[model samples]
Structure formats: structure tokens, C-alpha cells
Target chain A: MNRHILSVLVENQSGVLSRISGLFSRRGYNIDSLAVGETEDPTVSRMTIVVQGDDYILEQIKKQLNKLIDVIKIISLAPNVSVFRELVLVKVSATEKNRASITEIVSIFRASIIDVSNSTLTVELTGDQEKIQAFLELMRPYGIKELVRTGLSALQRGDTQISQTVTE
Target chain B: MKAADAIVKCLQKENVEIVFGYPGGAVLPLYESLRSSSIKHILVRQEQAAVHSASGYARSLGRVGVAIGTSGPGATNLITGIATAYMDSIPMVVFTGQVSTELMGRDVFQEVDITGATEPFIKHSYLVKDATQIPRIIKEAFHLASTGRPGPVLIDVPKDVQNDRLDYVYPQDVSIRGYKPTVQGHMGQIKRAIRKLRNSKRPLICVGGGILRSKAQEELANFVTKAKIPVVHTLMGIGALPVDHPYYFGMVGSHGFAHANRAVSQSDLLVVIGARVADRATAGPGLFAKNAEIIHIDIDPAEIGKNLGTLIPTVGDAKNILQQLIKGITSLATDQWVQNLREIKDSQKDVLFEDRVGVNPKVILKTLGGILEDTAIVTADVGQNQIWAARNFPVTGKRQLLTSGGLGTMGYSLPAAVGAKIACPDYQVVAVVGDGGFQMSMFELGTMAQNGLPLVILLFNNSRLGMVRELQNDGYGECFGIDLTGNPDFIKLVGAYGFSGIRVHNDDQFADAMKTGLAATKPFLVECIVDPKESTL
Candidate 1:
């Protein structure tokens, strides 16, 4: 099944995030990406979780999550129509011989090499999950050593917003 | 008059009595001013407790709760409490003394940007640069914090501002640029919802916490009766309709009544009011009203079609909306549909009732129900205590049951009970908490003792995190790290806090303890040691 993006509003309290993630993990559901950040309202935080399931299991997970003490609301953004992105910093070893090829690859992907030393080069990339994954696979052959990827952060494509609905 | 006088006057304007907090260097001036002021200051062990206490005070009183702390560590400690209150939509105002304005942003001694740190968690935060603004800011803070969807607001006062002199004038009214809250229902949406309800055969009303917040119980009851629709309540919607009312179909959700869940699943037209259609309440969106054309009526427009995917989405106040709906409902009848719901309700009425010794949680709750008047509002925490109250406590009147259903805050019961007691002083309020949760805000006993608000606290001592243990048994296949080894003696704990305390070992003892505790003209704690293995949910 295609992954769906869900934004959850939860009480910003201890053990709330853990409880939600625990429920997902315990249910044997694999999460593609999950990112949490404070919303415009301090009392509530927005959790964007990328989960792959049909309408049934996704709704089931959402319902179980609502049973948590800190959870306030949940909304699933329309897939394909939504805009999603993830930030990644990857470290790879490059030499003078392959440096031009790596640079060419980096330019092709529109990624920037943030750090460069004699033995190691660090490239920072920001894009959708698929685009980042494609670049990572190409870098794999060039002795990819370490990678740090930020979980997916998403917003709906158009004027549709979470806060607008809650405000009224 | 000094700037301290201005600050004190601002507090008076807000009608702040008790502030839960620990004192420190940056706030010494405010603490000094507090000494001369009539406002009672509660000395909490930690700044976190101060916020939680303030949350409790707010939830119990319907007034904006106040808490204070010093800058740096003090402000950081209050983060959790503020976050907790923010999440639960409780109104609270937190005051943190900052380093002198001159030294701000330089990371001077005990200087932290409290306003910046708290920016993410507070509804709004102000870093006071002028003494004259203190009164207006304090007034506005309370206004902003308590009004609209109530939340925590922070005022970071620099030491200099606290000590600066200003001509104090308290504003009688508050005005803000973009904070107007809609108070009434939209007539157009109400008419549409009413029209849909009148035509539908299998209509079910799903209620949420918004009903309680709006004080629309009578309106909800009237609409249900006039429309002849059965109600299925969410956990937070508990007391919106009397639990035993003939039209009441029971609670809906994961732990909801079987019939209520089935009714929601089987209904052809769902009339959701004041509810967010939370995942638990719907048992997953796919199963909730899949066959029904949903009519969502909520004050928060975001809640409409946010979860269950509705056709008729109405956004407005519950009471106002219900009133409008009633006006539009033209003598509609679906008697056979109502009877079908009743039959379903009757069929799934069996919950496992274990009769045993040593004061079972259910028995204690039932007994408490018998002793208290029907008007008493019972606030229950999560875990065994919540389940016990849900299964055994009977809510007979309006605005009687208040709990943290969506967030299910474990330490929520005691604080919320305090708020409910303050809101309706004539009605008896009891906080039913398990041992694990009781320890979270146990210090609130001091608040009760100091305020002279008598409350009956039923502490179900299971010597474990009973709910987690149950989960472990069912899901993990074993119990580990859930049992309590050194549970606090609740009686001694209450006694230490200068309140009356009693221990109940048996059925007869529980009754006597409850009587003795309720008879005392002070707050009382009744500690009943419940068996660890038993769970109602």
C-alpha cells in the first residue's frame, strides 16, 4: 500500500510521544517517517507520521492513538496531493581521483557539499523521500560511510491547513 | 509607589489568590512584594509542581490558574507543567522572574531567555520591559490564557521591571487585535444539520468534551429528546447526557461500551456534536459511521470532517448550535430507529463484576456513588481508577463527570476535581486516583488544606501501575517493571499535608472511612488497597 501522511495534535506532556510510537511499534506497523514539532499553540504539538497501510489499519492506528491521554486530534493528508520533504546529511570518503565524479553527482542531485577535508566530504541534501533515497543509492557505490536523515516534514499542497480548521 | 506596587496591583486586578511555585534570586523582588500582598503563595518543592498545581487550580476553579518561579532553572522546570496544561487546554498563567532587562540576552548570571524557551509551549509570552505595562499585561495574560480555547500564558518579568516604579491603573476591559472567539452557532450550518437529522432514520449523536466546556448539557438533552435521537458519548462527553438516561446509548471508542461502538458503526446518519472524532472514539475511522452520512457540529471548525469525513460540517458553540438545531427540527420522529438502539444497548450490558474482599476499586466507586448525592461530580484519572469510575460511578445530573479523556492525564483527576469543586462549590466533588497517579500531584493536598476546600479523595492502592500491568499481561504475555515496590502510605501522606486521612481494609471499613472523611470539615484522603491484578477495561 502507498504511504499516507498524518498530522496528529497531542498534548505536549511526558510519555505522550513514546506512548504513540509504542502503539505503532507494538501493533507491528512500520512507520516510514515521523517528525514532531511544536505548533503555533504551545499546549499542542503536531506529529507528522508517514505510515503505510490501507484505509482500515491506518484508521485503526489513529483510533488507538487517540485513546492516549495526550492525543487531541488526528488528520490524514491526501496522498500524492500533499507536499512532503526530509533533510539528510551524508558523509562519504572522496579522493582527488573520484572527487570530480562525486562533485558531478552532487551537482546533478542539486546537493551541496557542506564540509570537505582531505579524506572525508559531507553533503547536505533536502528533498522528498524518494528523491533523497535515489541519491543515497547512487552514493552507496562510492563508499558511503555515515548518514543522518531527518524524518519527513509535510504540509498540504494548497490553502488547506491544520490550524485554520482548529481556529474556528 | 514602587514598581513592585504596580505588579501587586496587577495581581489584585486579576484576582490571583494562590500561586504554586518555588522562590529564587530573580524573583526575590516579586516574592518580597508577595509578602505584603494579600495573595496566598503556595511553596511547592519544584517549579514543575508549581505549574501542575496551577493547572489543577485552574481546572478545578474555572478561573485562570497562576504559578510563579525565578529565571533560568526555575523557568525551565516549569516547562513540563506548562506543556501539560497547554496540551489539556487548561487555562494557566505562569510568572517567571527574569534577569535584569539590562543583562538580558547576554547569558548573564541566572539569565535565560524564558520568553523564547517558553514560546513553543505558551499561548503567548511577554518579556516585560516596562513597569507600566505590568498591570495591562497581567490583565491581558489572564484574559488571553482563559478565553477562547483556554491555554497557558507566560509573563517573563525582568528583575528591574519588577522593581521599577509605575503609575498603576488596572484596565477594566481587555482588547486585542486578532483574538475574538466566536460565541454563537452559524445559523446556516445549524439549519442544514437539523434538516438532515429530521429526515434520517438511524441517527446517532456523538458528544465530546466541548459540550462540558460550553456548559450545554441541557441544550444537548433537549435536542436529543426533541429529535428523538439516541446519544453515544465519548469519554470526555461523559455527563453531557445522564449516563442512565433512557436515550443514553453509553460511551463509544476502544474502551467504549460494546453497544455504543456498534451503534456508531451501524448508524446511517451520525450527528457528531462538540466532538473531534478522535481515533479511539471512532475505533478507527473506517469502522466509524462508514455507512452513515456524517453531520459534524463543533465550535472548532478544524474538528469537522477532520477525522470521520463528514458531509454536513457545522462549526459553532455547542449550546448555541444545539439551540439553533432544535429551532430547525420540525417535529421529527424515528421511534423504531430509537427502539433498535435501545435493544442493542440492552444486549451488551454485561461487564465482568468480581466480588471480593479488601476494597475492590469498583466496589469503592459504587459505594462512593451511594454515599454522595447524585449531583456530585466525580473526576477520575487513567488506569484502574478511571475504569472503576467508568464502570461503577453513576452520573445522574448535569455537569457531573470531568476527566482528561482525550489526553487521559494520569494526575488529571485531582487537579480537575479541584477546578470542578471551585466551579460548583455546593456540589460534592471527589477525585478518584490510583496510587501511581496519586503520587504525581500528591502535593495538591496542601492546596486543598490551605484553601479550606473540602474534597473526598478516593485513593485506590493497587501497588502497581495497574493499567500497564494489564497491557503487559495481554500484549507482552508477562508482567515486568509495572508493580510498585514502595508505594507511599496515602494516609500518612495526607496527614503530613495537614489533612485528615483514613485507611480502608474491607467493605465495611471503606464505608466507615468514607463517612468519617466526608464528615470532616476539611479535605480527606481515603486510601483503599486494591488488588493488583484486577482491571475493568
Candidate 2:
């Protein structure tokens, strides 16, 4: 299986998201992660979806997504050519003794200490999937109190725009 | 004018003469508005029947059928019908009355998230929030429902929105940014398909419901005649070509004719038009047309390679694609191929069924086909009855065999026949249903009785779900839960709805009974007591 990152542009309409997610579930296609936000045009929304499937499954996914009335366009962003990032907030149980070490690890990973309490330190990290995984592994020794993640959001590195391209 | 009145006005503007619907509390205002309108409303016994009936109307008339229902359970009931229409690509517009805007999402009395529930199946849906936008939404709904890759579209209107007053002016045109459908095939792809067809010694044209949806029957006929190519069809493509046409082979697929499947398997070039090639049509995709180089033609680009690989994917409306193909290609020497197919078809012509106890359904349908007018419409319910009708009924001239081919929903025929008869009052309409399926929608007898339609109900009484029984008997060597031992006396049952019927026990009794039913001035039922041992093959 291969992981595919698809950048989809859709109408900013209510129920469009449900339509996309419902399609995935109904067709038995798995979604690894999905992030949606408004684009330059308020009437349109861009969704960055991460999925795992083979070539046939990937083609089926793209074709099926194109069939949705609200979906305007879809482009698969290649991993090497795209800039992918995910934001994760990890609240670690840090006592005064281990707080200094935790801060040192956080600085090494270039993560920010977003929030701090007597018994916990919340670290905010934004990086690609690999970087996020590495940081989380290093923080595992310090008992994790709470964790949240904004799934993989991606775009091409160059000047090419998805909206301007005509789809088949 | 009230938004409800505007909705009626929009229907009138769309040239909708009738609507199949049931009234409920949430739609009281809309029903009140309809009460004052000239459009005729057929009150179905259930909301499901309304959608099925509308489907029949749409398929028969080549127009978008309209159906209405009130919310929660009523909307939920339309689900099966909507999915059926979606699968078969039938054009229909369905409206459901929602609880007032404030009551929505609150689990109030008679409230459901219908739009969300139907998202996967519906072509497009609108949950009307702005009363002033009612006219535009209605216009767009009709346009979307009837356009490329036709299917059911739903509009859920809140009760308060229907009551809200607004000056409505229906839009003259619709332009949905994300919904433009390709109408013409790419020229380069068409040329590639033509070249492939010319080079192949054994070529076959597999037509589907898209031919009918695009009204490309004439084009298909012309193309086949000029090219001398043999033709086969999917279940939904039954009426695309006359059954008796010289070049037409039977349907292809699992329950399809052995000869037709052979033709598909043997062909070197297979041009599939307007078919998704679903599992039922292909049996299994891996081996289907393995030897053939496939050229998939469909209005929806997504369907081209969904199931099977395509050598040349031509995306466009079937009618337009066929026209393009016809313009580019000349007569081909496929005589040897046609001869081979004919020999194969002839060898499989006399399929012998086991000697059972009662009337043979195959003979009943064949005889009925002979008796009916060339333009007659037959709607077959699911299961054994559907296969029996699809195989035996000779669909000629303008005749149609409407069924829930995609969803295989039982209880479709009776109400669909109602819609067909209403749509084409001059044509003879027949509902071929099995005992189990008949009871599923027999309540529609009241709808037929009230309408005083001159229709025929051909009920095959096997007293069991024969298809499931056959599968059980084949797979597990046993049968269970397939019995309908307490099936009512169907003739007496129809009489309860103020209609007359006749029961026949054997082959000799059917033609006469059918003749009598057709001669009757009101809705009539002809129940043929089929042997429980009868198999679909």
C-alpha cells in the first residue's frame, strides 16, 4: 500500500464535507487524515486528504471524488514535491525535576511550550509526519497527559496552483 | 405569493403534469398550494411507492419524474426508491417536507436529517433554508435531476419556509460551477475507438440504460445496421433494441443468456455504452471480456474504468457518442462473427426446465408479450419474476421493461406500472410481480383503483422467495425462511381494493385470462399459480 495526499477544491456548501466522508465510508476506502479550510475565495474550500491505498484504489478514489457534485477539482500532491505539515499539541506530565529536561528536548525539536502548569507542560509542534513521529517518540518517556493533532495538510512546493488547472 | 405557491408554479413551468405523493403534517402548506394548482396528484399508499411510480413515469416518458413526501419516516421510506433510481440512472426529482427550521436537528416530532441520510445515493440534494431562493433551487434541482447521468435529486423544504411569503421568479437557466457534465465525446478518443473497431475481426456492442436515457435508440440501431456489429445489452438496456432485431443478441451477465455471455467472452473488441459493468453484469470483473479490448463510453467519466479496464475511455452522452462513432465508421465485414454468434444463440434457444407442478412463468410472460401491443410497458419486480420477465418478454417497438435493475428492489413493478400508465395513458401497462413482491406493494391497488387505470397486474404465485430458495438449494443444499405459506388469495385481495381479477392454474389458462384483463375497463389482475420448484434459469 502507498500513502496518497490529495488536494481537493470543493464548493463552500453545507453538507459537502459529509458527502465526501460518507462516500469514503460507503465505498470502503480508508482516510488516514483530512484537513479543510477556506481558500482565497470564500465560496470555495480546499481539503487536504491523506489516504493509503494501491494504484487501483487511488485511481478509484480520485474518480469517485470527482463524481461528487460539490467537488470542483482534485490533484494528488507527490510527497517529494509537496510541503506537508501537521500540528500536534502534546501535554506532558512534567514535575519540577524533569521540567528542565523536557524543555531541553522541546528546544532541540524546535517546538514551542504553548502552555505550562504545575504538573504539566503543553508543547506545540508543527512538522511533517516523520518529524512529528520522532518528537512524539522522544516525549513518550514523559507521561503524556493529553494529545491532539491537526491531520496532515499539504500543498505543492512550487508556483503551480490547483484551482487554475483543468481536470480531465 | 407564498413559497409553497411558488413551488407549484415552478413545477408548472417545468411542464410537470402530475406528481406522485403522500401528504403529512409537515407538508400541509405545500399540499394546500397543490390543491389550488392544475397539476394532478396521485396519492400513493406509501412514500416508497411514490418514488417508484415516479421512476416508472420518468423512464417511460423520458422526462424527469416528480414525487413528494412529508418528513422523517416518509422521507426515510423514499430511500430505497431513490437508491434504485440512482443505480439505474433514472431522472427524478423528489421533495420532502421537513420539520420547521427551528425543529430541525433537535430530534423533534417527525424530524430526520434526510439530506445527510441520502448523501451517498442522491445525485444532488438541497435542504432549503431561504424561502426567497425556493424558485431558483427548484429550477436547479430539476435541471440537475434530468441532466447528464440522470438520477434522483431531493429537496427538503422546512414547513415554515413553505409558509413564508416571497415574490418568486423562476430562473431561466442554471450554471452550477461544480456540476457541468460533458455532453460530447472527445474527438481523439472517438477516432481511436473507431480504429480499434475497424481492426478487430470480432466486435460487439454492449448497450446499457444510457442509450435509453439519452434517447439514442435510433442512433444505436443505425450504427449497428451500418457496421453489421452484433449487439448485447445489460438488464437496464432491455428496450434499447428490439429483442427480435437481426443483429441483437440477448442480455449479458450472470442471470443473462448463455449465448450472450459467450458472445461477450469471445469478442475481440467490446464497445460498452452507458454501462458501469456492475458485478451482476460482469459476474466478476477479473475475467469479464478478458480477451476483448474494451472501449467504455459513458456520460459520467467516473464510470469508465470503475470496474473493468478500458482501452479507450470515451466520456460523453451516449447519444452524442454514438452519433460521433457513426459519423467516423463505415460498414465492417463482421458476417462470420455474426454467424458464429447466431449459431451459439440457436443452440441455447431451447432451454428445458424441470417438469414442475403448475404454470410455467416463462410461457406466461412469453404469451403475455405476444398478446400485448407493441408499445406496451412492462415493469418487473425483483427476484425470479424479474429474470423471467427480462428473458421471456419480447420488448419490441416502443415497448419498455422497467425494473429496479441497479438496486434490485422488490415491490417496484406495481407502483412503477401505475406511473407508466399515467405517463402514457394510451399504452398497455403490465406489472409482472412474484407472490412475495406483490404483497410488498399490493397496497398500491388502492391507488390504481382510485385512478381507474386500465392496467394489468401479472402476479406469478410461487408462494416463496424462489430466487433465494434456489440459491439456498444450490449453495447450502437446503432452504429456510423462503416460505410464504399464508399468501392471501390474490384475486380476492384485489377485489378488496374494488378491482376484479382471475386466477389461472396452468399454461392454457393464462392467454385467455390476460385477454380478459386487457379487455376490462378498470384495473385488472391475472394471477398465475407458478410451481414452487420453478427456477429462474
The DockQ leader among the candidates is: 2
Docking class of 2: medium
Candidate 2 interface RMSD value: 1.0
Give stretches of model 2 more than 4 Å off.
Answer: none
RMSD of each: 8.2, 1.4
lDDT of 1 at B90: 71
TM-score of every prediction relative to native: 0.73, 0.98
User: What interface RMSD does every candidate have?
Assistant: 11.7, 1.0
TM-score of 2: 0.98
Tens digits of per-residue lDDT, candidate 1, A89-160, equal 999989888888998989999999999988778999999888999999988888888999889988878897
Query: Going through the candidates in order, what is the number of backbone clashes in each?
Result: 14, 0
- How many angstroms is residue B308 displaced in model 1 relative to the true structure, after the best TM-score fit? 2.8
Question: For model 2, what is the error of residue B28's alpha carbon versus the real structure, in angstroms, after optimal superposition?
Answer: 0.5
